[model samples]
Target: MKVLAVSSIGGHWIQLLRLMPAFEDVTVEFMSTKQSFSTMVDGKKFYSIPDGNRWNKYGLVKCFFAILKVVETSKPDIIITTGAAPGLIALFIGKLFSIKTIWVDSIANCEQISMSGKIATKVADVVYTQWGHLEDNKVKFFGNVLG
Candidate 1:
């Protein structure tokens, strides 16, 4: 199966990388806010999307289009993310394309699911939370990626 793994930079990227092991048997491509992150993936296909948050409407629009283009070109069977904004955008785009989507909320949100994650729960086929306490009917606790 072809998979597009996406996230923003920093902790989200790190958490996404930790899930690489699960993609070992499948074809996986990486996408993030920073192009420099391509190097960390060791020559695998990589895409860079604009980084945005709820505060930056313009940037979010750019990110949405960029992710839409990537989804169209990559044509991945599944799209997964450890999200901030870019990942959330990808998930929405993936759903539009009828691609399976998975969202792994950042481990940093120990207290509650991030806002993006809450939104993702509606689109993603499966939404995973690092904190067991955060699990509900919509969100699932699938163990911590960092650990």
Candidate 2:
């Protein structure tokens, strides 16, 4: 399957990168806010979209279209993200296209799934949390990125 792994820079990127080795026999691409990640994710396709958050409505809108463009051009079978906001936009687009979507909440949200993660429950086909306690009616805990 063609997979688009989306994340912002820093920890979210680190979490997504850790999930790479667990995935096999598929084409994997990356979407990030930093073009420098191209070197970190060498041998895979990479896209840099505008970094945005819920507080930044304008930036979020730009990122939404940026993500849509990537999904449209790549036609990925599935879109997965360790997210803040950009990945949520990808999930929304994937859902619109009837593509599979996965949202892996950032490990930093040990106390609970982030607000973005909570929002994703509405659209994501699968929602994963690094913390066992975060698993509930909406979220699933299947180990963690660090493991």
Which candidate number maximizes TM-score? 1
lDDT of 1: 0.93
Error of 2 at 69 (Å): 0.9
Which residue runs does candidate 1 get wrong by more than 4 Å? none
TM of each candidate vs. truth: 0.97, 0.96
Q: Which pairs of residues collide in candidate 1?
A: none
Question: CA lDDT of 43 in candidate 2?
Answer: 87
Q: On residues 58-102, what C-alpha lDDT tens digit does candidate 2 reach at each position?
A: 999899999989899999999999997898999999999999999
lDDT tens digits, residue span 1-147, model 1: 999999999999999999999998999999999999999999699998888998999999999999999899889999999998899899989989999999999999999999999999889999999999999999999799999
Give the number of the best model, judged by lDDT.
1
After superposition on all CA atoms, what RMSD does each candidate show versus the true structure? 0.8, 0.9
